[model samples]
Structures are given as structure tokens and as C-alpha cells.
Target: MTIKSNTRPVASAARDFLLTDSDFSRVRALIYQRAGIALGEQKREMVYSRLSRRLRELGMSDFTSYLAQLEAQHDSAEWQSFTNALTTNLTAFFREAHHFPLLAEHVKTCAQPVTIWCSAASTGEEPYSIAMTLIEALGNRAGNASVIATDIDTQVLEKAATGIYTMEQVSKLPQERLKRFFLKGSGARAGQVRIRPEVAAMVKFGQLNLLAPQWGLKEPFDAIFCRNVMIYFDKPTQNRILQRFEPLMKPHGLLFAGHSENFSYASQPFRLRGQTVYELDAKRGKGVA
Candidate 1:
């Protein structure tokens, strides 16, 4: 008698859509080409989970069919949905507490009419935090300051533009700041808070892709808060982005990165100023205080 087989088939039956290796590879390439995000091997499950919702919404049964449709339509709006689906928008108000103080000091030294670029606006928290800091630092002069908040995901930018947040989202803020900056809601909108009009006005939300050829921004910034964004890109992508950032920044401009990111490896245009904060190299940074 032959021994019974102990092995079983792979569990494609359990998944709503069959994501073959080929399908995942194509997705990885497409997103990298479009958005400059490098998906690693461990992200296969995450890629499948996020894209599966899109497939389900489109009534598709397999990744192959969905990806084929996506590839065929060069000018499809679905491309935005796909990019939005894969984007990770994690942020909180003053999440990196130290950076704000440094920014406050940096802007004080700059000329009037300060401008900042929050490269990954992400639900509006970071840019709003930057706005609040500018107000606190510059006081009445804050009227001349502005934040250009942008993200690759249009969906998040739409949410960011609303400037509303649940109480839970603002829970950690001090009572004084809460009263000063946000309007508490009531009745149907209880437990929600809307950013005050004055604070909201300081931020202009837009959609931008880091990989895009032209950012369409004419003004060079006094500071660029590209925080926590470069981690999603690979080394070459990071270098290219850092290179692009150099020309966009004022001589004394600061680049605040994520806590976990280190730019010392790419130390040509920037040097570590404090913690994850960077400033233009001294040789390249002359002429400005």
C-alpha cells in the first residue's frame, strides 16, 4: 500500500483574488515607476491586502485582470486610486516634538515672509503643526508665513484640506494650545474639532508626486519638512530626491527627516545639524545667516 500524502496545495482558494508572483512583481514595478516607492519582498502580503480592495470594488476576480486593465488605460483615473491605495499616511500633531523648536529658531533668522514645504502633508497634522509653530515663533509676523502641504495621495489631501479631526486625534495637545488653535465642535459634530480658520488659512494643500519631473513650484523655501517620507524610497531614489531638494531650499534651509532616517550616508549637499535635522553643507550654504 502506498503511504498517504501529507502535503497540501497552496491556499489560493482562501483568497478572494489570486495574486500570482507575476502580478505582485508588475504591481511593484508600476508603483515604483509612478510614485518612487520601493516595495520589498516582505510587503507582498500588504500589497495584496491593499490592492485586493480595489479589485473587489471593481468586481474583478484576479490580480492579473485588474493589473491588465490598469496598464491598458494610460490616462485612467484609476491610477490615482491605485496610488492612493498603496500610500501610507501616518502622522500626528507635533509627532517629532524637537523639530518644531529647531524650525522656530531657523525661521527667526530668515528674512520676512517665510515659506515652508511639507513634502508629505499626510492628513494635515504635520503642516498644521508647522503652522502653529510659526504662529508661536513669529507672533504677528505669522501672517506673512505660509505652509505648502502636499502628498502623493489625493484622497489624503482632500481630508487634509477639511482640517477637521476627532478629539482623540487632538487629545495629546495641551489645553492652552487646544483652545488657541482649534474650535471644539458640538451637537451633530461633537467629539470633533476643526482647525481655526486663521490656522487653516496658513496651509495650502496640494497633490504632488516626488517622482514627477516638474513640481511646478516657483518659490524656493526657507525650510523643507520632508520628514518621514524618504524612508519609503530606495537608496538611489533617496539620493535623487535629496539632490532635487538642494536647489529648492534657501542657503540656511533645514531638512527635517524621520527619527529613524539618517542622511549621513548621502552627505554631499546636507550635513547633520541636530538629531535627524539637516542643513546644507557649509561650502554650499554660504551667504545666508
Candidate 2:
């Protein structure tokens, strides 16, 4: 996931629609206001490349007209399309492998019927991985545990709920895990695997925007997997989200972050417990009561 810093259009002469600086700025503002994603100037080319397809599909000739139509319709379905377009969903099964072992060890100490939230569940891989880890850790008791997987993108969430993957997607997984957790597809569905019914039953998928005014989630979680999601947000937005997560977490609950993220700056409520892992500050005592 190397993002190119060059802001220049791929080929100005070859582009069908013109993306002026103003148009890009509007896009940046709109996305930030809606989803709290902070886009850098380097994303200019990426924005144009992604949004140009929208223009074509909508029969829009230029960014100006497209943006104007988007702004005028406050309840437009296009807004979701815009957010989904700009969102970067890079994920895989057992990504950042170290976290799973830590998770398995941590959940063993938590109360029975452990609840975990995969806050940025991209295409079901992370949540499924969590469910697999739980099954291995809790054995028969795993039936009582659950994983709540959520993403802001509806399209990806739909795909995630299907619990199916291409062979290439599951190639890196251990053969034992592949055999135990997934069913091999047949005939027309060859080369793809479907997650076992038991595994799929352990996870529940939903659409959630972290920036929403009311999250509506009632249960307190023993662990929250919000890895890599905060990188797209600015510092203020990140801090705000962490603040919101505090009350939803059970006492001594763990917060797993991406390898590149650091929450030490927000030391009032969280402290680094391991590599990119955070726990409620001991002094905070029982999580934001």
C-alpha cells in the first residue's frame, strides 16, 4: 500500500473529465466532514482515478457538475458511493499475525462468553480470523463467544456476509485451518472456498461509520480490533474516536491497533501494553466510569 505522492493527473490530455484543484479540495472537505478521513494532497491522482468511473457511470461530464449534484442532494445514495470509492480496504486472513496469538492469550483471561468487535472488518477476513482464534482458544466454550464485525462500506459488508473467498485468498492459511474452517467449493464454484457454517455463524456483520453521532451499540466488548483504520483520520479525529471507544469497552479491555499507529499521545485513558496494543490506563480505573 504505497501511496504515490505525485499529485499530477495520470495524463491530463487523455483524461475524459477535468479535475480542477477546487474539485479535489471539495472532495477532501466532503469526505472529511462525512467520514473523518483526512486526505493528503498526494491523493489527488488517486481521487481522480477513482471518481472518474463514477462520472462515467452517472453520465457526468465533469467533476464540477458531479460535485454540485452530490452537494445538492443531502440524502443522496451517491454519498455512500463517494465514501466507498475513496476508502482503502487492504486486508487479508491472519494479517499482522502476531496479534492473533496475543488475542488468544488475552481472551482466555476474560469472562466467559467473550465479545470482540472488529471495528474495521474489511471483507470478513479479520473477523473470521478472530472467530477462528476464539474457537481454538475456547474449544466447546467458543460457542458462547461472538465477533461483531462492522465496516462503513455497504458493498464490502455485503461481500463479507457471504463468507466466501477465492483460492488465492486462502492460500497462505495453514492447511489444518483451511480444512477445519472452510468448505471447498465444487464444479461452477471451483477455486473458491466458503467459511464453515459454524465459523460464519460466530460473526455478525453490519455497516457502521465511526464518525456517526450515535453508534447504537449496546454491548461492552472485551476487545476491539480497530487496526489500520485510524491512519486515515487526522489526530483530532483519532483522539475523538478513541474517546468514544473508551466507554464501550469493558474494564481492562484491550484495544488492538495497526503496527504503524501510536496512541501514547492520548495517555489519559490508554497505555501501550504491547506492539500496537492498548489497554485502559490503570489509573483511569475501570474504564471511563
Candidate 3:
């Protein structure tokens, strides 16, 4: 059996843990089963580094013991930590600015209450961006819009719900826009800004594993942002999730994808709307004919 590069050759005595090939394969499989994240072989080293601290916090010396304990305990909470550890979260406010314009247009025209789901909310920027766009379009009526921001990583969701960010973190936002939607901290909390109550009120955060069998959301969304996170999933998983999303979307509801993912592979259920944005096929699922 070959030891994985990240844990093999006993590279240094300073290394506290060993992540064997077996360990890598088992952990990756578990993550896929639990969260639909398909980490490739190249990620072995990265996973080792990310989860090593988890092992340390558990007082375990190696991956084998930690994994066995997980299996023996059927530790669902522990599994969440495992999922959070391996998931990659890279997001920004208005990360893909173009999508928001059409989204805003949709919200403005929507007679029915608008609902948007930020499927991989990651630290809250995207959902807040969605909220800001809705606010601009609907003004006081923005209260009628719904934004459900979710992620499998509860850690990030907690931070996302807080809606607080460093000035430097949000400096890219235009100054006037920033002042309009955010509350600048003072004194003890200087250098940070919190999403104003009205904007923060627009979003509701939850921990959702996309691969989970049942999605409890009652209402179909007008636009769904399941962006850059899909690149971590295999094609079949991606397609399955897209299919599941079909029934959960309005006929012309748009699906925003990440820059790195192309939904053509899952085109049966979604048709390209714009760059990395898709709309549910009218003929598929419950879409209007």
C-alpha cells in the first residue's frame, strides 16, 4: 500500500500525523457521501493540513484513529466538523457582478413575492449582495423579498449570519453604496462594518448539505445561486443536484453558477441564460409550458 504524499516518507518528525492513501480515500468518500464534495487526489496534502487541527483538537495522533472513532461513534456532529474542514469556501461580495442586474430586474418585475436561495452562502457576501440588489430595485418593498442563504459548513454560516466584515474586506464596494447598506462600527468595534438591520433582515441562514436526501424548503425560488461550489462535485452529483433544483425553481427562475463550472453537462434541466447563469428548461420538471 502506498502512503499519500502528504503523509508519506515520514518527511519530518515534526509532522504530528500521517494521512495514508487509505485515509485519504476513506475521508474523501465520506465527504462525498455527506456533502457531495469530490476532492481529487491533488487535494490530499491540502486536506491533511486542513483536518490535522481537527485531529489535534480531538487528541488523536493519526488519521486512522480519528476515522475509526468517527465510524464507531457514528458521530454526526463530528462528521460536520469533518465536512467543514474539507469544504473550500472562496467567495466575495458581488463576486460576479453581472448576475445581479438580471436578478434585480427579475425582482422588480416579480408580482409574486421573490425568493432567492444562496446555496453556498460562504461568509454571507453573496446573499447580502443579492439583498442590496433587491433593496435598490424594490426599495421599501425589498422587505417582501426572501433570501435563504445556506451552506454545509456551519462555521461559515455563523459568520455569514453575523453580517459583520472588516473595512478592508469590503473596501471594494463603492463608498456611497457601502454607507447606504452598512453600519460602520465605532470605538471598540472600529474598522468593521455590520450589514444594516434592513439588509441583514433580508437573509435567513441555515446549514444545508446539498447532497442530503430531503430539502425542506417549502417555496420554489425565483433565482438560485449555487455557484463556485459545484466545481468540487463530480459530474453525476452535479447533474443530480441540478435535477433536484428543477422542481424547486420557478419556470424562468435563473440559476447562477460559478465561473469555473459549466452547466452544459447538466443542460437537460437548465438552459444557459448568460455567462455562468442558467434558467430552468420550461419543458422540464414543473416549469411552465
Candidate 2, residues 46-155: lDDT per residue as tens digits? Answer: 99999999999998898988999999998999999999999999999999999999999989988887999999998999999999999999999999999999999988
Model 2, runs deviating above 4 Å: 1-13, 282-289
Per-candidate Cα lDDT values, in order, are: 0.89, 0.90, 0.85
**What TM-score would each prediction reach against the true structure?**
0.94, 0.94, 0.94
Give the lowest summed-lDDT range of ten residues in model 2.
Answer: 3-12
* Candidate with the larger TM-score of 2 and 3: 2
Candidate 1 segments exceeding 4 Å error: 1-13, 282-289
Q: What does the lDDT come to for candidate 1?
A: 0.89
Question: Which tens-of-lDDT digit does each residue in 17-91 have in candidate 1?
Answer: 677777878899999999999989778888888999998898888888888999999799999999999999899
Candidate 3 clashes between residue pairs 3 or more apart in a chain or in different chains: none
Question: Per-residue alpha-carbon lDDT of model 3 for 140-186, expressed as tens digits?
Answer: 88878889999989999999999999998899999988989999999
Off by over 4 Å in 3: 1-14, 285-289
Question: How does model 2 score by TM-score?
Answer: 0.94
